[model samples]
Structures are given as structure tokens and as C-alpha cells.
Target: MALLQNLPYVPDTVRGRTVGRSFQAVFLMVLVSVLLVGAFGLRLFQLQVVEGDRNRQLADTNRIRLVPKRPARGTIFDRNGKILAGSRLSHTVSIWPIALPRDKWPMVINRLSKVLNVPPDEIQKRLEQAGYESIESITIARGISPAQATALAEYTNELPGVRLEAEAVRNYPNGDLAAHVIGYTGELTDEQLKARREQGYRLGDVVGQMGAESAFESTLHGTWGGQQVEVDSAGRIISILGDKPAIAGKDIQLTIDIELQRAAEAALGNREGAIVAIDPRSGAVLAMASWPTYDPNIFTTRITEAQWRQLQGADHPFLNRSLQAFPPASTFKIVTTSAAIESGKYDPGTVLPTYPYIQVGGIQFGDWNRAGFGPLSFPGAMAWSSDTFFYQVAMRIGGPTLIEMTRRYGFGRKTGIELGAEESAGLVPDEAWKQKNLDEDWVIGDSINMSIGQGFMQATPLQVANMFAVPANNGYRVTPHLLKDNEEHRNWKESLELSDATIDVLHQGLRRVITGGTGQSLNVPHLPPLSGKSGTAEAPPGLSHAWFGAYAPMEKPEVVVVAFAEHSGGGGGKVAAPMVLKVLEAYFKADQNAAAAAP
Candidate 1:
């Protein structure tokens, strides 16, 4: 009543109009309020039901993570079960960018650097280079010690989003025994990562970079596995939602013989040289030693700048000389000798003018002997390394015929061995090749020089070994391999089409090489009459590349050994043959030891 009395008094008509207007205004206000409340209710329903699962998924993703579980790396062993390369259990520390607090990144990196012995900037650089993914964990450091892992784990609460995972890293037991053939493993380069990412290669995955390791990478790389874990905002794992076990990589058995390899390396002994031995029957490489080899174990972790520079220095320790090409010198005469007999143009008894020098295409080429063996037969020419006689043989058969012969024996191409990307396809140049490459006309002098294994002709020591091997095996050549039983090889044999008479003549010539010729030094009394050819190639300024190639026991060739001593002055018989002899001596001694030990 007091509140009503405070209002101004009104007449009957004014009161009626005011009361009606007030009722209208109140009704409009009530309607607007009801509509707004209904809109709010609809929006709330849509948010709680229609968009619920999606929002929950986004929230869950913020806390959930997948961690890679690395499997054991494949073990590498010699055929005799001696471990050449194995794996050791190790740990890798990783970090997830999405779960890591942005403000604390510098602090985390700084702390990690102390334990990892890595620069903070380096860790940051690797992170930037990898281009972090929301769900993926970037590897902070690899091959961490157990102590380091424990230290990291002790502070897990503070080092949010970091994890330590057990992994298998490559280890070499024999050090540099068969380094070139066994090769080394390393982290993938940025280009390699880009190319292999689709195949499940991650940021920190390691891969074989050379030799058999690289050739068999696809077979050795096992499937990767991981665990999906639920975590809190602080990155503490609450539970594992799912887990998959990683499969170990397939172990590899190599045809390499550790004993023979060691013996060959020892014989090379700080010299810049190479020694390669092969089983002629199977074409399986027994030992391949390139001197000044490196330790594959050093490659398991990060290679230091100084170590890399040392490897890249003048010695060229990485070069597998067994697969590298050089002038065959007198050893190349075998190809000419074979061509002569195969062409049926010259018989073993065919005699040539014993001239000290020969002239062709307006050029005079001197014989190896200044006072040449006058009027020598084909056998005599090969035994004495008569350049004059070979010159005529080259003229008789022609360049095309010789090139064809070389191709038939697997020259000018890779040997298709298990050691990938480390072989050289020795050049077999002809008129057309010379014309295209040197932009010059082919001359008869080129053919003459080629006949003596010179002038545009190049052959790797392996090829040179194969050259003798073809004749030893009755003109059947097998693909050379390093794997114990490499199924990748097709067991392909190239038919050399050598006549029995030609083989006999070649055998006789090679026999005389040991009997009373350039390779006479190889005729060991205890050994069963070895047959071989010697090479002394002139490379200028450093002594000729001394080379020797042979197969044991003239009656039946069981193995072929080839040796090359780079710029080591002296004939093959004087420098390289002794290396091959030492290898053979060890080979026979091992066989004898095994035979005697047998019951």
C-alpha cells in the first residue's frame, strides 16, 4: 500500500491506458525470454551429443603417444659360424614434440646434452631437420649406456615426453679383417630418408651404406613395431593400450673365410695392395682383403669429423682394390693368347719373327724384352711375354674379335656379386668406343697395345682372376658372390666356346709361365705345379702396379688367387706372387689341420 501511494494518482481513462500498456510490455518481455531459453537448450544438446566424440578424440590425442620398439639387428657370420659382425643390446632416447612443453624445450635440450655428450644446438638442429610430426617421437640420442639411460629414467618426471628404448646396434668382432667386403651401417641421409620414408624408415633408422651390408639391406631390415600408451599432461605413462613385438632381422652367412681373410690381410701387411681368392668351381669369393682397412665398429655410432677426415686422406683406405681396374700388363696376354687359339688363325706351334720392336699405324712399340726372343712359337711367346708375337696375334684376330672374347668372359660389366656399388666394370675399349670417348680415330697401334693389355684396355684384379678362371674351368664362368648361398644369383654361366685344343694350348702356355718363364718364381716344390701369369703395369712416377693371378695344382684348379700391389715397383712374380703364395700356404695348412683333426 505504501509503494502504491508513492506513485502519482491517475483518473479512470489514464489508469486503464497505463495498465493495458504495462500488460503488453510484460507479455513481449516474457515471449523474448522463452525464445532465448529454447535456443540455449538446443545448442547445449547439439554440443553434448552430436559433437561429443570428436571433441573427446582431440582431447585424447593430446595425451596419447606411440613409441617405437626397435628389434635386434641381423648378425653377420663367416660360413664357419665365426662372428664377423654382430649386434649389442643398447638404448636410444627419444622425445615427442607435441607432448613436450614449448617453454621448457631449451631446458630439456640443455639437460639432455650433458647426458648424451651431444651439443644442445646439434639436438635442436636434428629436430628442425626432421620436421617434427605431432604423433612421432624424434630421437634425441642413440647408443646410450645403461648408466645414461638410468640417469634419464631417474628424472623422467622432470624430463617430460622423453623415453629410453632398448635397441640392437651393429658391432664388429673382427675389427678390420674383411672391412671392405663386410662394409658398415650408418644413419640414413636426408635424401635417403625422403626416398625410404614410405617404406617405414623413420628419422633415426640406420641403413647399410656399402658392400654386402648394402646389397642385402632389404632382406636384413626387419619390420618395426611400437606401443601405444596413454599419458597425462606431464607425459607419465598411465597404461599401454596396444603393443606389437618387433621382428628381428634375418641373420646373414657369408662365403668369406675369416682365416683366409686374416692371412691375406697379414700378407698385405701395411702395404697399399689387395688380395682376392675365389673357389673356381663355385665362383664364391673366399677372401677379399684391401689393405689399410677401417673398423666397421666405428660406424655404429656417430663418425667423428677427425676420423672421417683420416679415412678420406691420401691412402684411400676405402678403395677395394680387388674390384678396381688397372692395366693388366703381361697378365693381359692371356686374353690375346686365348683369342689367338680360339680364332684358329694361329696354332700353339705357329712361329713369329723374333723382333725387338714392332711398327704399326706409323708408331713403333717396343717389346718387354729389348733383345726379344727371336722367332718364338705361340707357347714361347706367352711364356716369355713376347709383345711382338702378341702384336701380330692382335692384328690377326682384330679388335672386334678380342672385344667379343672379353665380353664372353664377363668384362666391361659388373660381376653381379653380393657386394653392391663397390665394383668397377673394367673398360673394354674398341674403335667405336675410342672414337666416341677420345674423339679420335682408332689405329692399328691401339689393337697392338691392347693385345699386350695396354692402350685403353682396363681390367680389375677380380676380372683378371676370372680371366684365368675361365680357361681353368673349361670356358664356363660363374657369377662371383660373397654370400654363402646367395639366392639372388641366377646361377648363370656364360659359355666361352673355347675348343679343347685351345684350352690345351692355353694350359701349356700358363704351365710354361711357372716352369721357365716370367712367373717361374711361383713354381714351389711342395705345391703341385702352380700355373699363372705375372703383370708389371707402368702407371708413371710411382713404380708399376705389380699383379699376379693363378690357380693351384695344374692338374685341377680348385681355387684362383689374384694379387695387386699398387705403385709397388717390381714384377708380379717378385712382388704380388709371394702374397698369393702366402695365402695358398695358409689355405693348405688350414685344410691339413682340419683333415688331421678329423676322426
Candidate 2:
């Protein structure tokens, strides 16, 4: 070291200083490295342990969702197990928009439009609608044919956002047959959805709108199922985590006989009228028909605005006129005939004057026969449908008694049929009702008109049939229903408050009506002796509504039929009576055929 220092002491001293500085720099770098490692470890621990669950939940919030799956609706069958309304297996072409590339909307739309055979503009419109709903999948097309659906499924890999979903759509096999009783379904209204939201009804659910569909909604609408799915950032489904399978609704059996229903519809022949026939013993609606009818199948699918508007026309084809009421015409004589006998003030044999014309309440009343036919028996009065004769009988029974009798026969009120809101509570105007509704006092003319099934008195064809049904059923009243297992009606039929004697008198009068009076031409002497009353009432100035209320197999009547024609110029004897006859023949023929085929 001395020899080196003697050679270059200053140079040696500088080199030593530089070496010391290099060591200091290396130590400083090592300290900084340790600090950086420690900071990174602390941050890693905070993310993995402290807030792991919260972050996981946030991720799921952006990815996981619940999708609703509609359950299959119930099947509807006729009395003989014939299918009337059923669900058809259908498919929907839908799009989960979030799964698509954000910038590739136009390309997706163009490709989807070609495959779906839909307009590109239409596809875009549906895409916009889906986006507005955020997570909701939008339906591009419904009722997709099997071939189309298969084609769609095959190409789905290329169309990531497109989906082919299986769905159940309502189907009516009989077209317009039993349209009124079967009713229709439509998309859920806001009011309907709100009412059914807790039961899993959503904004896009289909719901029953009228007739049996509405009355049996709970029985028909099964529990909906759901699927929980995980999706990626662009709404691409990653996996289906879990699912609740949908349970199908129970099948319902109706009391209608399809053959009878078809016959009843045929009898109307597209006329503007209604016909109702019932099994007197069970209060089962054998057949119910309203003319100018529409096919309920139109409503089964997603009806367009134009089609819906067509359904709501001036003809009111959607209305079930069987439950609608007009004047009962001469059919109401059955009520007067019974009420008088029940009061014990008159017997079936009691003589009432039949006149060509009579003056009462400052209004002149005339008989159908211009020539005066002297005194006729009470039973014969209904047979002849003599207005003058009934006027006197009504005066004797008084307004209060007549109203009570009418109500007892199921008049002035709904028949409590299964059709629900399709029913109308026909009015039976009394002094009070008249004063309240018309702001006019009741006069003798009102009573006179009501006595002959005119004036403010109204009754449904169902009520007319029911009025005669009481007599045909041996004085037992039942709540009419369409369901096979109608416990309410089965239970209520046990307790009826009607006199057997009064019913017998009604039978006698209605019997005479068929044997000798208006409906005589329809009476077949060999066919178990039918009994019925015919009526022709004023309507629409120059027109008249025809009515016929009758029961078959008079000894123990199994069926009661009522036919009514609106704004028809002909009399009940010509129009409604013949139509009722046709239905009766059809019903009896069906029974005979069934018995013959029973083996």
C-alpha cells in the first residue's frame, strides 16, 4: 500500500471515494424495492379478503338475471270429451339484445331479417323496443312454423343474440262454434297485470278477457316458472344456473254437447239472434248460440289493431245475445200463468174474456186474431197468447205479485251462468224502478204491456228457457253452469221454493200452446208430446222479435229450449218456433244416436 501510494497517492484516494459511493447507491435501491413490495402485498390483501364478497355481488348484479317462463294453459272439452278449446305447441322468435355486439346492430338486423323473412326495419323496431325495456327479451315473430324454428335453431350459433323459444298458444278447433261461451284471450292490460302481479303475471302475459275464460282464469292459468342465468358484459349468456319448471294447468270439462252446439248454430243460419237450450234435470247448458258470430281463433294469437277493431263493430258479434234481454214476447205468458195459479186466485180452468180489441190505460190493445174469440180458458190464454186475456189476469195478480213471480223464475236478473261478465241482468220494471230510471210514474199501460211481455219488462233467452225449466224440472230451480262438476249448482238444486201445483198449471198451459196454439205446427204427435209457448213482440217500429220457449218429452222433460230472433218481420210461430223445433229434433236425434252407439 505504501509503494502504491508513493506511485499515485491522489489517484488511489479518488478511487476509494468512488467505491464507497457505489455501495451507498446499491443499499438505497434495495430499501426502495422492499417498500414497493410491501405496498403491493397490502393492496392485494385488501381486494382478496376485505371486499371480495361485495365485488362478487356487484359482478353478479351486472350479469345474473331471472327470466319468466309462461306455463301451458288448460284444455277445454265438451260433454262427450270432444276438444273445444286447447293449447297448441308454438314457437317464438326472440332476441336477447344485450348479447349482441354493441356496434354491430345494423349487420345483426340485416341478417336476422333475412332469416326471419321480416323487414329489416321491423327487426330494428323490435330491437329498439327491447332496448327500451332494458333486460326484457323482445319477440321478433310468433307462431313460428316448425321448419322456420328448426332453421333458426341451426343458425343460432352465428346469431348469438337470437333465440328460439317454445311457447303454448291457445287454439279453438271449432272455429266460431261456441265462440260466446268459450270467449277469448288477449294481452294483459295494466289493470289486469297489477291485479295478478303477485301471482307471477308480468307485463307481457296473456290473460282471459271474457266468457268462460274470464270466469275460470284461476283454474286455467297455472303457476309460471323462471330460470336464473348468468351473462357476460354484453349480455351473452354464460350459463343457466338454476330453473323452476313450469306446471301445466288442469284440463276443464264443460257441460256442452258439441253436436247440439253445432245444430243450434246451424239453426240460426247466421241470423241476428240467440238460442239457448238446457238439460232441465241438471241445469247443464246443452247448447248456447248467438248469431253473426265471430271466430274466437282470431283472438287466440296476438291480434292486430285492425283485426281487433273489426271485432268491435256495430253488429256486436262478441256479445252473447243468449244472456241479453229484450221483451219476452208471448214467452212471458208462462210467468203470468204460473203466478196467477200460485196466488190461488185463479185456476188453470179459469175463464178469461178473449177480445178482438180492448181499451185500457188510454191505450188500445188488440189480439193477434182480429176477429173476437169469446171467453177462453186460462190454459188456452197462453196457448192463444191473447193479449187482452193476459191484461185482465195481470190486473188481478197486480204489479208486485207479478214482479215476485218473474224474479222467482230467474227474470230481471242474471241466470248465474258460468259465462261471467257476458251475462246481463235484464230489467223487470216496477213502479219504483220506473220512477227512478225513467223519471216517470208507472201507469196502467205499463202493467198492461208487462202482462203481455211488453213495455219496460225485459228477459234473457236464458231466463225464458229457465222460466219454463222450473216447470219442466218439477218446480226445482238450479243455478245454470257450464262446468261438469258445478258444486254450487248441484248443492243449490236441493233447496227450491216453488209450488208443485203452480208448476202443473204451467205445464197445462204450455202444453195447450203446442197442441193447439202458436207452436202447434212444430208439435210431433209421435215424439213424446212436446209442450211450448210462442211469442211475437213489437220491435224497431215495423219489425218484431220472435220467441219460443219449449220443453221436450213432456212427461219428464229432459231439455228446455228457447229460441229468439231479433228484428225479424215474421211471428214467433213462424220464425223462433221452427228454429226451436230444429234444435229439439237435433238434440233428440243425438241422444238416440248415442244410445244406439253405446253398445
Candidate 3:
């Protein structure tokens, strides 16, 4: 009763308000704690479950990488299995810029420069390149010496990035002998990388740049292999995770006879032109030589800019003139003669009117030496290479027949040889071609000019050789081939239909040219009789470009050879014919040597 009277000063509402405040405070604290616990649980779940695999994969990628291991390049051999291009293991020095301390760069360069015999400034500049990656900082120097490699490895503790690596480099044993045919290889450029992206080649890869090397790049390059290496935190390789072994490239065997190639090259005797010889039956190119050549070995490793510029500036040294287009001069008369016989327009005994000069359409075309064999037969016309005689016949046969005949003889088209760049298709102007290109009308003068292999008529040395080969091969025109072993090139034969009488007459005439006429100088002394024709094409007020096309042993043909000398100014009999004779002598001598050595 006393306690109730004292409490009468405060209201029950105040007491109830105090109780509500206590409950509200407790509820607010509990809600805040629950929310904090849920947020912490979500963060832990994200770190351990949601993003765990992705982070783990990133870490693994950082700890390991695949590195390439180079495979051996294929070997190249001649028909006799003589090694022409081979490979050797060479050591090279490399650097990783990012791995080296910035302050130690100058010291490292100075040491490397002295050891490698390279200019210190060059080494320093390479190391200073900010864009260069750790893997590709060091440029190649002269091939590493044994002492230099030992010194580099010994100083590994001092030079962080410096290391020695073994690499295979292409070597040409014969130097410049078969430079054009053997070709060269070098490190791939950025443009080459872009071009070869589909080929699976990277920036540092090496690739063929010319000749047989380029023709068979895929087969020559082989397969690149690599190993996945597990590395520590410091990027030091701990172990090889797995490896894919490299597959070596297949060996290539060329149909070229090295001895004959050398002989052919020597016979040219510092002349600027080309020589091509082929086995008539097999179409295997025995020798194909382009003069003013370069040393392929210079490009095998790394060619200096100066050396490369010298080669590029050389006098058409890179020009494979054997397969290039040029006026066939009088040599193409054989084709005209063959066409005449095939058309039954004239027989060998048919006499044609001839003179020093023949006027047609206000243009008078004259014969060589301004002298003609008067009232000549077909054989006499060919022997003298009479322009007037052939002109009359060409006009009678018409241009279409001549064009068809030339095309049948492998003119106005590629020779289909394995050479990467061949220029067999020369101009065989007709009405359409003349109107489209020359913007003029075709006239009798043009036809007359075409008859003598002039005025827009042209042929490659290879085409001329092929033209001559038809008669030697008995009208079976086999497409000339440089690679006889390639499985992909099995179907390259074409049959040229011609009568035996035509071949006999033409052969007899060609034999006389070598024996007593224009090509007399081409006769081999005390050897089998060789048949050939001389050609001296006019070139803008110059003497002439000398040319000779021949096939040996008139009775039975074994090889067909053609030689052309550009801007020689001498007659084919004087320059090209003599060279062809020397080549024939060497070829027969080598053949005899081989026969003597045969088991």
C-alpha cells in the first residue's frame, strides 16, 4: 500500500513507453548483425566458389607456356645424289631484355660486343628497344664460336638474360653454281607473317624465298613441334609437362646433273643469257643455267643489307632468261616450216622466189647480210633463214594457221615447268590482240614480219628448245620438267602430231646448218654429228641477239640443248653456236665418264 501511494506521481504510459524503447533497440541491433553476417558469408562464397576456377586457370597459365623446338630442314641433292643444300647445327647468342636489370644493360652489351665481335652501339640499341619482348631482344651476330659460347655460359650469373641456343642453318656446298635453282631461305618478316598466317607460321619462322625452295615450301618447311614446360614463380623451367616431337622434312631429289650444270655454266663464259638442256624422252631438265648469278650461301644465314643491295642491283642477275620471253629470230622458222608441211602447202622440193628485199604493204623486209639464196627450196630457205621466202609462204598460209601452229608448238602459253616463274608465253599477235594492245590494224607487213619471228612475235629460250625438241622427239612434245620425282606432276605429257617426212626434211636441213651452213662452228670435233640452227634476232639498230637451238647425234637424239646470249651483237654461229658446241662436248664427256664407272 505504501509503494502504490509513492508511485502515483508517474503515469502507466511512461512505464509502457520505456518498455517499447527497449524492444525497438534490441530488434534494430539483431537486424544489423544478421545483415553483416550474410554479407560476409556472400564474400567468402564468391572468393572460394564462384571465381575459383577462373583464377586458378590464370595462375596456371602464368606458371607454364609452350616453347617451340625446331625440326631439321630437308636436304637437297642432284640427280646423282650429290648433296647441294644441307644443314648444320650452329650455336647462336640470345638475350631477354625484360629479364635483365635496366642498369646492367650497358655492361651486358659491352661484354657481348667484345665477345661476339659486334659493335657495342648496335648491341646497346637492341637492348634499349622498349617494344622488344623478353624473348626476342638479341639479334643474330656472326655464327657463335666455341670460345664465345663457353664464355657466355660461364658469365650467366653476371648477365641475367644472355644465353646460348643451338639452331640449324641452311648451307650450300656448291656456292653460286646452282644459286638460281637451289634458292635461299631467311627469317620471316612481318609482311611474310601476315601472308602466311593460314600456314601456321609465326614471326620468327624461316621460309623459302625463291626457286625450288619456294616451289615446295610446304613440303620443305616440315612440321614444327614444341613442349609444354612447367615453370616456377620466377619463370625458371621446373620440368617438361609434355612434348610433341618435330617431324623432319622429306628429302628432295632434282633431275639436274650437277656436272652438266657446271659445264653449262662454264660454257657461257661470262656471257649474259641462259642455257637449257632436257632429256628428250623423260622431260627431265639435265641443266638449266642463268648467267650473272649470285651466291645462294650468302642468303642462307643472314644477309647483310649491303650484300643484299649489291645482289638486288646486279645486272638482271635474278632474271631467269632461259624461261623469259625474247624474239626467237630465225629459230622460229622451224615452226613455220613444220606448219607448212603439216598444211600440205609446200613440200621440201618446192622452190620459192627470194630476193635481198621483199616489198609488202610499203614495208620492205630484208634478209640477213642483205643477201638471199635465189630461187631457194624449203631446205635452202631454212639454211639461209631467208626472210623473203618465209614471208611469201606465211602470207599464203594466213595468220590464223600460223597462230594455231605456234600454239601447238607450245608458244603463247606457259611451259608448265616446275620453275616458280617461267615466261614461255610470248606475243603471237592476231587481229584481236593487235586491236586490243597495239591499237592498230593487222596487215600483210605484220604477217610477213611474223613469218621471220619479228614484229611482236617472241619466244622464250625454253620454247625454242621445246620447238626443236619436237622434231628430235618424233613429234611427241613432253612438257619439260625440273623435278622428276614429284608425285603431283605425273600427268604432264602432250602429243604433237606430225608426219615422218616433215621431220626428216627438217632434220636434214638442221644438220646441214651445223655441218656447212650458219651453225658450222657448233660442230663437235671427232664426235657424233649434231644438228642445229643459228638465229640472230635484230634489236633496234644493234647487230643481233645470238641464239642457237640444237639436238645431238642427228641419227638418234638423246638431248636437246638451246643457248641464247642477249645483246651479244655477234651472229649465233659465232657466239651461241660455239658455246653450244662446248656444252655438247662436256655433256658427252661426262656421259662417257659415267658409262665407264657404271657397275
Which candidate leads in TM-score?
A: 1
Per-residue alpha-carbon lDDT of model 3 for 163-271, expressed as tens digits? 5778787888898887777778876766887899687675456778777877767877888787787765444678999899988778888888888899889988688
Worst 10 residues of 3 by lDDT: 130-139
Which tens-of-lDDT digit does each residue in 533-563 have in candidate 2?
Answer: 8999898675899988889899989899899
- Model 3: per-residue Cα lDDT at residue 191: 82
The C-alpha lDDT values of all candidates are 0.83, 0.81, 0.78
What range of 10 consecutive residues in model 2 has the weakest lDDT sum? 487-496
Alpha-carbon RMSD, each predicted model: 3.8, 5.7, 6.7
Residues 151-207 of candidate 1 have per-residue lDDT tens digits of 998877767767787767888888888999988898888899999999888887888
Model 1 lDDT at residue 42 = 87
TM-score of 2: 0.86
* Whole-model alpha-carbon lDDT for candidate 1: 0.83
- Pairs with backbone N, CA or C atoms under 3 Å apart (clashes), candidate 3: none
